[model samples]
Each structure stands twice: as C-alpha cells, then as structure tokens.
Target: MADKQNVVSVSDRIPALKEQRKKRANRRLIFYLSIFFILIGIVVYFQSPLSHVQQIQVEGNYTGETREIIDQSALVSGESIWSQSLGSAKERVEQIPYIEEATIERSPDNITHYCPRTDRTAYLHNNDQFIPVYGNGKLMEEQSLDTYPSDAPIIFNWQNEELLEAFFVELDKLGSGMINHISEIHPSDDDPTLLRLFMNDGIEVETTIENFASYMAPYPTVARQISEPSDGILHMKMSPYFEAFNPEEYAGRFMKSTLIRVMVG
Candidate 1:
C-alpha cells in the first residue's frame, strides 16, 4: 500500500512540472513578440515619407524667388523621417536671410509641408516699367514690368522696411476694404510724413502717415474727404497735408529723401 501511494504522488508531480513548463513557454513567446513589434515600429518611423520634404509653399512673397529660396533652406530632399529632426530643419531654413519665419508639418499621409513666412510684399512700381521696392521702403533698381509682376502702387524711392511694415499694420487696423479705390500709395521720407494715395476716381488723399489711421479709419469718409478731385500729383509730404492741384507741378518734389548707398557691413 505504501509503494502504491508513493507512485501516485510521483505521477501528480510530473503533470505539475509540465504545466509549469507550458507557462514558461508562453511567457517567452510573449517576450519575443513584444521585441518584434518594437523593432517594426522603429523601422516604420525611420522609413516614413515625412522624413523628406514633399511640398514647399511660399505665401506673401513678391521679390524673392520661391524655388531658389527653398533650395537654400535646410530641407534636404531625401532622408528617413525618424532620422530627420524638425527643429534642426527649421533652424536651417530660417538661416536664409529673406525668410523671416518658417513652419514645417507632416501630414497624415506622411508628406512633409514646408512654408516660408514673410510679413510684407515688395510693391514694384509699374509705370511702363517695374521698380523693385523692398517692403521696408528701399527702392531697388527699376526692372521691366515683365520681370516683376504685381499690381501694387508705385512710390518714390525710399529704403526703410520698418515704415512700410508700419503702413501694413495701420492698413490692417483700418481694414483693407477701406482703400478699395486706391491705385497707389506714396510714402514720403519727412517728419510728420504722409501717405499719398491715388484713387481710381481721379482723386487723391493728402494725409500724413501719422494721421492715416484717424483720417481713413472709416471707408465712407474717404470719398467725402475728397475736397477737390486731385488734378495732379498729390503732396502729402507735409504736416498740414495739401493736394498737389497740379501733381506734375511737383514732379520731383520731396520733403526729405534718403538716398540708399548700399554698403554691405
């Protein structure tokens, strides 16, 4: 009887050992699967299409060549998405002098989008010819209208990006629809300066740059303030603005002029 009891006990111990071995095998399988999935995730991240720039879009750009600018930026055409660093790419693109700010984003489809930012547009004067004027207020050499394509107004030569930027800010404050009839904007380089706007109605507004917001803050006031149809070039280059009854009369008139002598420092 004692021998039989011992045999049964041994049999039970065998099954228990087998059960323990099966649990160990399942644990090992789970461990290998976890590692495999992790490796796959890493491979997918590195191989994603977002790793390379697929599209480049430039908005509010006028004078700068879009393709040329993109080529100069930090974005490399082909690379692994996981290996590519977004912050590093942005820093590189922003290094280009013209691009004030840049933004990069990856779409759901894994395409990278690069956008270069610019606040102001260069208004090239078109008078049978096109003249490149920096948004700040510097007048670049005149080029043929065919070369520079834009409908922005022509102003006298000046080189102050800050002033032009201010004008844009003021325009935003006043609302663009207020100047629908405006054909051109001429800002003078003098104290108590003015922005001479030529309207399509054969009239012009001779208001100081400082008073521009207050005067044209409302759209309806523009037509009512046209005391007289401007006969010629309007001179807003003074404190108490006066219309150039004969604009041609002041053909080369300026209260102050800053002749830009380009010196690369």
Candidate 2:
C-alpha cells in the first residue's frame, strides 16, 4: 500500500497537461481577433469621405474673383487630403497680381482653406483703358478696363517700374484722405524724380518723390486759406507757395499782339 501511494497517476497528469494547452489556444485566438479588427478600422478610415477635401474656403482680403484664386491654385474639390500639394498651391496662388502672399491648409472635416493678402494701391492710365496697380507696385495689365476707376489715383506716362513702386511706398504715409484728393500724377519731363500732381479741387502741385506725402500734408489747410484755388498753382517742392495767374495782364498782352498784327497788315 505504501509503494502504491508513492507511484504518480498517469490519468491525473494527462488532465493537467490538457488544461494548460487549452489556455494557450484561447490566448492565441484572442490576440489574432484583436489584430484583425485593427486592420479593418484602418481600411475604413482611408476610404471615408472625411479624409478627402470636399470644399474650399478663403478668408481675408482678395480683390479679384474668388474663382480666379481657386483656378490659380489648381486645387480640386473631392481630392484626398493626403494627396493635396500645399506648397505648389501656395506658389501658384501668389503668382496672381496684387496677391503679395498666399498660404493653404487642410482639415479632417473635408475642407481646404486658402488665404491671400492683396492691395490695389493705384492704377496706370493707358488712353481710354486702365491697368490695376498693387501696393507692391505689381501691374495687372490683363485686367485692363475701358471705364475709369475712381477708387485710386491715375498714374500717367510713368516709364520706370522700379521708381513707380518706390513712389507708391512713399504715398502711403499721407493716409487715404490726402491720397483720394490726388486725381492724376505725372513725372516731370526734365526729371522723373519730380512729380506733378493734379488735385481734384482744381490746384496743380509740384513735389519730389522723396518727401511727397509730408510736403502735401499741408495742402488742405493751404487750399482753405487761398481765396481762389482754381486760378493758381501750389509749389511744395521746397517751400510752400501759391503762384496766381494774372488774367488781366494776360488779356492786355493778347490785345497788344492783336493790335500789332492789325497795324502791320
């Protein structure tokens, strides 16, 4: 009986080994099911519309048509967000005149955003047609129009683009009130650096490009002091002064010329 008790039971050992194997099989099956579910989630996410750009939005100032900005970017709706080329789109959008800078971004909500900063500072007068000029001095000649645009002053017969751009930068200091009064501006025949401005209130002005805004700042006050603004010219090149036309002397001189011609004949 003591020897029989010390002997291990083969049937009992078999049941314990089988129980350990079953636990291992169950663990393996659960791990495989978790991995399969994860893969399915990834596949569903990529195929969903939320991962694509369904619309485009723009914020901030853009003077041109919204369609033109979209066309220039070459970004199409319904394209995959992962495939959207943000860098190239920004470069193309910045190529449009008056757009100083452009930036693009996308979101998981199926939207693409584009923003551009632009300024229409002036206009170039070309006969009956006109071209839009930006604050950075970029010209939009392609969008020229037959009708006159009164929003900005007309720059006529300007030959140098570099100088014109610099002049525009100087004009900003005067503020909108002074700038709007400027009807037309032309470079002097003798010196392009000298600018001749035609005021909307019927006064001619002469000033240099270096300090144009500062010199013209006193115009409204000076104009108010003058009794007759239409019959004189304001010189702001160095010292501010008004030179009035002597119509009586001019008429007398004309009479003398006609008298001489009549007597000689």
Candidate 3:
C-alpha cells in the first residue's frame, strides 16, 4: 500500500513539472516574437524611402508665392516623415495674409503637399472713399479715392449683401484682362438684379446679375468692333447690342428731364 501511494505521488509531480516547462517555453516564444517584430519595424523605418520627405509640393496658391509659402512651412527635404508634425506645418503656412486657408498632406511616395487658398480682393467706392473688399464682399480697411488702384473695379452705391456676393462670383469667372476694362459698377435703381458697368473706354453696359459673366466675357471682342472713341450704352440684358448716343445731347436731356420732373413734383 505504501509503495502504491509513493508511485501516485511521483506521477503527479512529473505532470506538474511538465506543465511548468511548457509554460516557460510559451513565455520564451512570446518574448522572442516581440523582439523579432520590434527589430523588423526598426529596419523598415530606417531602410524605407517613404520614411523621408524628398519633395515639397504647393497648390491652390493664387498669389504665385508658392516658394514663400513652402519656406514658411519649414518642412525640409530628407527629414524623417515619421517625426514631422503636419498640423504644425499647416499652421505656419496659413500665417500669410493673402492665404485664407491651408492644408497639408503626406504620402508614402516621399512627398509632402502644402495647399493654400488666397483671399480675393476688390474695391468698394462710397463717395470719395475707397474700401477694400475681401472674400464674400466683406469690407476691409478704407483708403482715399485718390490712392485706390485701377487694378479692380470700383463698386458704387452697392449696399445689398446678397447681390454683392453674386456680383463677385460672376466677376471672378471673367479673365483678368476683361475685368481690367471695368472702371465702375453700380446697382441699377430700376431693377435690383440689373447692374450698370462703366468701361475704361467710356462705354456703358446694362446687364443682369444672373448672366453677367456670359455677357461680359465677349465685351472685349465687342468693344474692338466698335468705332474708336466710341461712347454709348451697350444693352446686354436680353439680346446683346450696342446703341450710339451723343454724349452732349444725352447729358443735356438728362439735366432738362431732371429739372422738369422736379418742377412738376
């Protein structure tokens, strides 16, 4: 009975030792696997070309100051992309006054992208004062009429915000050369949707806001066809056509009509 009991106790001890050995072997396998994966990650990080930035690309910059924006980004080539903070770089690029918004992106092809949108500027004329208009016709700093440049059209008595936004949208569609010929823009008193455009060549245009771009796009071609020193109203509301008028006679009629209306009233 004593010999049988001894054998049972020894058998139980043998199984416990095997279990302990198996547990140790599993632990060793897990530790080795962890080390192996960590080494592989390190090797890939150092050896892969994607880990470094090789090129910097800029887009959506309207001022043509791409180099300035890239310099401001502070993203140096050959730098480790893993260590780059894209958020911080984007913030720096947006510091430029003309840039309205900026976005940054990185790719595994070793490229860093910096995109910036510039604010659109226009001039608003109130009497003798010229105010700078930013995005969506929001007025900025005011300047004297004498100092205002002819680069942008001067808006006259345009107080409606919605109409101003639509006007800018249409104006932006026209090319810079076409826009340069426009000297002043006024909201028509007769119709809120109609706008009166005064051209640099002393020609006037009457067009609606909805199709302003389509009408204005062909203005340069139309102006060239007319006789030199031409001064008249080009009605572009429905059908596009030009009407010749004697400036002196028109002015006299205007004054006389104004006086007669005032006296009658």
Candidate 4:
C-alpha cells in the first residue's frame, strides 16, 4: 500500500511540472508578439511622411527677400529631416549675396528654422535705381529709386569697383549723424581719386576719397558758425577752407568761383 501511494504522488508531480512549463511557453509567446507589433509600429512611423520636413521658418533676415532666400536654400517640404544635412543647407543659403551668415536648426514637429544675418551698409544709385550694398561692398538686388527712398548716401559713377569698396569701408566708420548729412557722392570728373560730396544742408565738399571721413568730421561745427540757409563750397582737397557765396551775386557762379576761400581748419 505504501509503494502504491508513492507512485501516485510522483505521477501528480509530473503533471504539475508540465502545466508550469506550458504557462511559461504561453507567456513568452505573448511577449514576443507584443515586441514584434511594437517594432512594426516604429517602422511604419519612420517610413511615413510624418518623419519628413513639413515647413520651414525663416528669421533674422533683413536685406534678403524671405521667400527668395528660402527658395535658394534647396530645402523643400517632404524631405527626410533625419537625412538632410543642416550644415550643407546653411552653406547653400549663405551663398546668396548679402547673406553674411546663416544658421539652421530642426524641431521634432517636422519643422526647420533658418536664420540669416547681414549688414545693409549703403546703397548705390545707378540708372535712377538703388541697389543695396552690404558692409562688404557687394551689390545686392536693384530696386526702383521711387520704391526705396534711402537716407543713405548715393554713390555715382564709381567705375573703379575696388576703390568704391574701399571708400565704403571708410565711410562706415563715420557716425550716423555725419552719414545722414551726406546726400550724394560722386567721383570727381577731374580726378577719380577725388570725390565731391553734396550735403543736405546745401554745402558742397571736395576731398580726396582717402580723406573723406576725417575732412568731413568737423562739418557740423563749421556749418553752425555760418548763418542760416548757408550755401558754400567747403574745399578739403588741399587745405580746409570754406568759400561762402552771396545767394544773389553768385547764384550761378558758385561752382566756378574761389572768392571766399577762408581757411577754417
């Protein structure tokens, strides 16, 4: 009777072990199926357009047309954000004239940000049109003079582009008050190295291109010494002098006369 009872206990233990093994197998199958489904979901999300770039936001652009800059970037909607090289994109965008620097960034919401920086130093007047000139003296797009009325000085007939660039570099050093006083700058018909400046206060200045800023620095102080509605020729080519004109007597002879060549500096 003892041996029979022992045999029955051993048989029951075997069935219990089998049941535990089956439960483990079922759990493992469920876990593996769950993992497989999650992997499929990840793959689907990556393959769909959800992971691609949908929009581009531009900022910090002043001279460049925002739409034109974006077009030049070569970054289009539906491009894979993960694969697109942001460094290369920035390089392409900076290639546009007047764009001194550029920065690019991406967001998780399928959007890209492009920021461009530039310094609009001056404008060149050619054929009755105004072209934007950057601090580096590179010419940007041209627009009608009427469309863009500029307080910046207008450069005229500067055939030597190299010299013009250098002149602009020097001009940028002057303060805004002095810069605003200048209305027109033209290369002297007598000497290309010399320039004639027409001031908004009706004073004409003649100086070498190299000495433009220094010679014109004291113009405001000198101008105040004269009476109101002053009209004169401030010659700075050789020595600082002012030739005042009697509005009635020298009305037409202003440019030809050296009558009141009084030394000011």
Residues 1-265, candidate 3: write the lDDT tens digits: 9999999999989989999999999999999999999999988887886678878888776556677788888887888876778888888976654556777888864545446453444588776778765443455452345576677788888878888888877776765667788888888665778787888988777787897888787787776666655556676644566665655655522111211110100
In model 2, the runs with Cα more than 4 Å from the true position are 1-39, 62-64, 112-116, 246-265
lDDT of 2 by residue, 1-265 (tens): 7666556566568889999999999999999999999988878877987677778876665454787788888888877777878898889988887677876877774444455555566788887788987766677898887888888888888888777877988776677778888888988766888887888888777688888878888788766665664444566745676655544443311111211110100
lDDT of 1 by residue, 81-171 (tens): 4445667766776665445666766543243435444333345444556654433333445233554443444444435657655665555
TM-score for every candidate vs. truth?
0.58, 0.74, 0.56, 0.69
Q: Among these predicted structures, which one has the highest TM-score?
A: 2
Per-residue lDDT of candidate 4, residues 97-187 (tens digit): 6777788888864545455554665678777678876655567764435445565777877788878878877786666678888888888
List per-prediction Cα lDDT, in the order shown: 0.53, 0.73, 0.70, 0.73
In angstroms, the error of model 4 at 88 is: 2.7
As for model 1, its CA RMSD to the true structure in angstroms is: 9.3
Clashing pairs in 2: none
Model 1 regions more than 4 Å off: 1-14, 33-69, 92-101, 107-109, 114-150, 159-165, 172-175, 187-192, 219-221, 224-265
- Evaluated at residue 233, the lDDT of candidate 2 is 53
lDDT-based ranking, best first? 4, 2, 3, 1
How far is each candidate from the true structure, as Cα RMSD in Å? 9.3, 9.0, 8.6, 6.3
User: Model 2's lDDT to the true fold?
Assistant: 0.73
Error of 1 at 169 (Å): 3.1
Give the least accurate 10-residue stretch of model 1, judged by summed lDDT.
Answer: 256-265
